[model samples]
Structures are given as C-alpha cells and as structure tokens.
Target: MPLALYLLALAVFAMGTSEFMLAGLLPDLAADLGVTVGAAGTLTSAFAVGMAVGAPLMAALARAWPRRATLLGFTLTFAAAHAVGAVTASFPVLFATRIVAALANAGFLAVALTAAAALVPADRKGRALAVLLSGTTLATVAGVPGGSVLGTLLGWRAAFWAVAVLCLPAALGILTGVPADRGRRETSGGPALRVEFAQLTGVPLLRAMLLGALVNAATFAGFTFLAPVVTGPAGLGEWWVPVALVLFGAGSFAGVTVAGRLADRRPGSVLAVGGPLLLLGWPALALLAERPAVLLALVFVQGALSFALGATLITRVLYEAAAAPTLAGAYATAALNTGAATGPLIAAAALTTAAGVLGPLWTSGLLVAAALLTALPARAATTPGRNPEAAR
Candidate 1:
C-alpha cells in the first residue's frame, strides 16, 4: 500500500478508536457518572444519532470543498469533541460532546470513503476501501481493549483523554500526508440537494444499501451488549470480556479481508453468503452464550460474519451507485449511522422485558432476517455486472 493510504488508515484508526471506546467503558462510565448502565449505553446511541445526522449534512455543506480539506476539517472536529468529552464533569455535557464527536466521525468517514476511492484506480476500489476500513476493525481488536483496560485502571475519563490525545497526531498526519483533490461538482441551486436525494431514492441499489445498514444495525444490537452478556449470564469475568472482544475483533479482520476478496470475485454471491451466515450465527450466538468455550468460538464467527456483511454491502453500494459514487457513499454512511443509532436502542428495549441476554440476541436475529429479505429485492433489481477492474 502507498504511504498516503497508510496515513489515512492511521487517521481512521484514531477515529474508529474514539467512536467505539464507549462500548468497553460503559460499565465504568455508568459507575462514575452516577447513571444506570442503560443510560450509559445511550452515549453510544447519541453518537450514532449524531453520525446519522452529520454525514449527509456535512457532505451537502462540503460538497464544493476539496476532499482533503473536508477530511482534515472533520478530523479536527473529531479531535476537539474528544478533548471536550475528556474534561466534562456534567453528564449532559459529555453527551453533547459525544454527539459532536460522532458528527465529526460521521463526516470524516464519508469524506474518507470518497477520498479512498479517488486515491486508487477504479478496479482497486474495494481493496482500497477494505484497507481504509481496517482501521475501524483494528480499533475493535486493539484500541477498544486498551481503552477498556485504561478506563478500568485510570477511570473512564482517561480513556476519553487518550482518544483526545491521539487526535493531535492524527490531525498532523492528515495535514502532512493526505493529497489534495479538486472540489466535487455541486448541483446548481436549491433544487440540487432535492435532486440528489431524489436520485438516491429512485435507485433500487440505494434501497439495498439501506437494507444492508438495517442488517448491520440489527446485528450490533446484540453485539453492543456483548460485554454484559459475557460477564453476566455467560459467567465470564471482566478480564475475560476483553478477551472475547479481541476474539471478535480478530474475526472481523479476517471477515473484512475475505469479503473484499470475495466482492472482487463475485459481489452478489458474497452478499448471499453473508446474509445467511449472519442469520445462522445470531441464534448460535444466543445458544453459545451459556458455554464459555462455545461462546468464544461463536463470538469469532459472529464478528466475522457481521463485518463480512458490512464490507460486502459497502462494495455493492459503490458498484450500484456508480453514477453518483460520492453521494452514494454518503448515503451508505447514513444507513450505517442510522443502524448504529437503532441497534442499541432496540437492544436496550429488549433487555428490559425479555428473558436474559437471549432476548436481545433473538430480537436482533429476527431483525437481521427481515434485513436479509430486503436484499432479495436488491439482488433482483441490480444484478452484478462484469467489473474485472474491481478484482484488481
């Protein structure tokens, strides 16, 4: 890979770490902030909501700016949000900071996808995106675990501080390493945004992208509560929880790589495989939660399948939205953020009335099934055409 790509990946690593650290720190945060664990989970939901709202809004506003400038500005915003979050004593303030951080994160990722596509040749887009997205997966494997450990030992505030600290270098890296690109062609007048929105809506492929997002959200609903599920009913210690997360993260890394390769070879087939695997894995995840050894194995499978689905869906969206790739990418980000926001809320609701951890997992599985059904229309509507370049 090129050095620029590596730097972008590093920036992504920082961003991803900042975004996901909340999940691991939820228990510690709840205790420190004097809120219920359920409330602490809302921090993640808040960030997701911010991301959902920010991606398109930022994209629309920044439509005429150079891609490099947009990316750098978003990174700066991400850094600032983390810094504020680190120092805030008030819970509401912290929540607001999370929203700011999430918005920046959402914008950063949307721009980054567009930048990554521009960085590489058309044929190599999938691989390039995979490399960029690997940063998020790496955060899951290393950053989240480290953040959790740091928060446990030093207080959850320290974790946020660490994320804030990393932002400085990330900003510097972006300034130094990211290449400048010409501004995107903006649509003329007030009708432009409406036209773009209408174009996206009219596309069957975009609907598939949204469905993909829903599936991803449904899976996360269960996964977000993973620490509790493992540490509580599953009878694992806190120390063991991070280990399970590491296993899941490792699986995600493999899944993403495989998905990229498969997407290059056969996009539709990869999507088909991912949907069934996800549907099958959730029930298995529920069953395996009772057995430590089995649960460990299942966690790996769940992470792999879930992330595989995500990567495949992204590649499909890129392909199908070829006419308006940048806008399509923004739409994809929107779907994902929407899912991120929905997952935790849904899981939290299920946890209230349903039997143990099984409730959330079962509910998530059913939702994923519905998402899978949405893909059928997508597949029928947008058949994968030859793209030999994608294989490259």
Candidate 2:
C-alpha cells in the first residue's frame, strides 16, 4: 500500500469515528435530547438511510467530477455537519445534521472505495479494502471508547465536536498527499451514467451486494444495542461498557487483518467456515448473556466472526462489480449502509416487544442465518461473455 492509501485510511478513521461513536453515545444522547431511547436510535437509522440513498445519487452526480475535489467536498461537508450537530439544542436539528453528515459520509465512502481499489493491483484490492476498513475497527477500539468516556464525562456534544475537528487534518492530507490523476474520475466510457447503472444493477453484482448487505445488517443489529446489552443482562457496571466495546474492537481488528490475506483467494472456503461459526455465536451470546465473563468472551468471538464475513462479502461485491469500476464504490457503499440502516430498525422493533436487551441477539442471529444462504458461489456475472445464467 502507498502513503496515499494510508492517508485515505486516516480520513476514513475520522468518518468512521463519527459513524461508530453513535452506538456508544445513544443512551446519553437520548437523555440529553429528552427523547425515548428508541427515538434517539433513529438518528443512526437516518444516517444509514442517507448513506443508502445518497451514495449512488451523489456518486452519479459527481461521477464526472474530479475525484480529489469530490473527496474534499464531501470531507468538508461532513465536518460542517458535525460542527452543526455539536451546537444544536433541538433534537430535530441534530437529526437533520446526521442525515447531512451521512450524505457526505456516503459520497466519501463510495468514492474512497474506488480510490482505494484504483491505488492497488487487482489481486490486492481485498487487502487494500481491509486496510481502509481497519479505520472502522480502529474507531471501534479507540474512538468508541473515547467517545463513551467523553459522553460519560464531558457530554455527547464534546464527542461530536471532536469528530468535527478530526476532519480538518484529513482534508489537508487528501489535498496534499493523494495524487490527482490516481484518485479521481476520468473522461471514459465509465463516466457515462447509463453504463454505470447498467453494470451496477446486473444480477451477479446485485446478488453479491445482497450477501454483503445481509451480514452487515446482522453485525449492526447486535452492535447498535451493545451498551444496553452489556449493562442490563450481562450484569456489568456502566464503566465496563467501554471495556466490552474494546474487546469487540480488538477481535474485529484481528479478524480483518487475517481476512485481508485470504479474502481474494478463498472467499467461499472462509465464508463456509466463518459464516456458520458466526451464526452460532449470536444465539450462544443471547443464551449466555447473564454470565458477564462468558458474555464478554462471546462478544469478542462474535465481533471477529461477524467482521470476517463482513470483509469477505465486501470484497466479493467488488469482484462481482468489476465491470462498473467507478460505481463499484457506490454499489458496495449502498449495500453495506443499506444493511447497517436496516439492522438498527429491526433491533429497535425487537426492543419494543418483550424481547428487551437480548432481542438484538435473536435479530442478529436471524439475519446471519439469512446471510449464510446467499454465500454460495456462482459464475462471476461481471465477467464478460460469462454465463449470466449460472445460479446465484
């Protein structure tokens, strides 16, 4: 990986911090905003919805724009949204800021996926993406805990302000480090919107994207409710919540590091082994929730397995959409965020029922079981002259 890739990852770290920090802050934010916890959780859903909808739309509009400019534009916009969010007293204003930040987040992620792929050899795209996504894992480890502490001590707004400040250096780094020609749009056949959409909507790519989406949904369904689960049924003190998050993050980092090496070469084999293991881990987690030590251990296990499957399917989406080039980023972003968006809503509904804290685990398990079905291999649809008829 080049220095530019690391720069992009740094930028992603800033964005990832803002994105992941919400899970840890939800309880405090709900109290501060004077709303029900479930209502406060909608902020996350709105962010995901914005990403799900905005990624392709923004990418389509900016497809012909310069990549460096596009990235900087989104970065600045994202920072400003956080800045706005930090000062807002009204929950509706804060809610609107999340949508804005998410739109900017979606555009940056969509473009960044292509930018990362363009920076590496075809064979290394999997590793490249892992390097990029490690930012999210790192956020889980450092950012979430730090934000939790901040929310616990300094109030939730401070974490939002910190996120806003984090973006400035990322924008500067992107401006100075990422090479102009290497990062942006080109005036080629790919710049045509019709061709890009046609490539994106193809069944093979769509199937691959669907698998990625489902696994991510499963991951977030459990993750979005982590603090509550840890405090309530796990019998852990409030202070131990960040400790639980760190354990999950550490496991995730390990999983993705291992995944980077295998994703391109043995996706099916790894998915076969890791997918079933991850599915079982979820229900086991719910069953063992009352045992703090056991619950914490399973949290780590689930995090590792969930991200391994997550990273692998993400790489698979990129592979299936190889023909789309630019819009591959949008397709992948849309898939992951769409899943992220759906999981929280499902978990929220489960919370409204008698399921309570453990409900998210069952919700996660169901999605994981569904995701496993879509993990089977088929002929690559993005491959020209290949039989599109190969069963997905």
Each prediction's whole-model lDDT (CA): 0.77, 0.85
**Candidate 1's residue-wise lDDT over 1-392, tens digit each?**
66677777888888888777776788888888889877888888898899888887877777777777777888888888888888877899999998998888887787777777767777777788789889888888998778888887888888888887877787788788876644343455324565666667656666757776787787568767888888877898887767877887888888888886776557677667677888888888787788898888988888888888788777767666655645656777777878888888888887787566666787678878988777675565334564745422
Model 2: which residue pairs collide?
67-184
Q: How close is candidate 2 to the true structure, as a TM-score?
A: 0.95
Quote model 1's TM-score.
Answer: 0.93
When summed lDDT is taken over every stretch of 10 residues in candidate 2, the lowest stretch is: 383-392
Q: Over the full model, what C-alpha lDDT does candidate 2 score relative to the true structure? A: 0.85
> Could you give the C-alpha RMSD of every candidate to the true structure, in order shown?
2.7, 3.1
Query: Mind giving the per-residue lDDT tens digits that candidate 2 earns over 1-392?
Result: 98888888888889888887887889999998899888887888889999999988888888878888889999999999999999999999999999999999999999999889888877788899999999888888888888888888899999999999999999999999888886657747454667768876577778778888899999888988989988999888878888888888888888888888888777766687888899999999989999999989998888888888788878877777777777788889999999999999999898977879888889999998987665545534212222222211
Which structure among the candidates has the greatest TM-score?
2
**What TM-score do all the candidates reach, one by one?**
0.93, 0.95
**Per-residue lDDT for 117 in model 1?**
71
Model 1 CA lDDT for position 381? 38
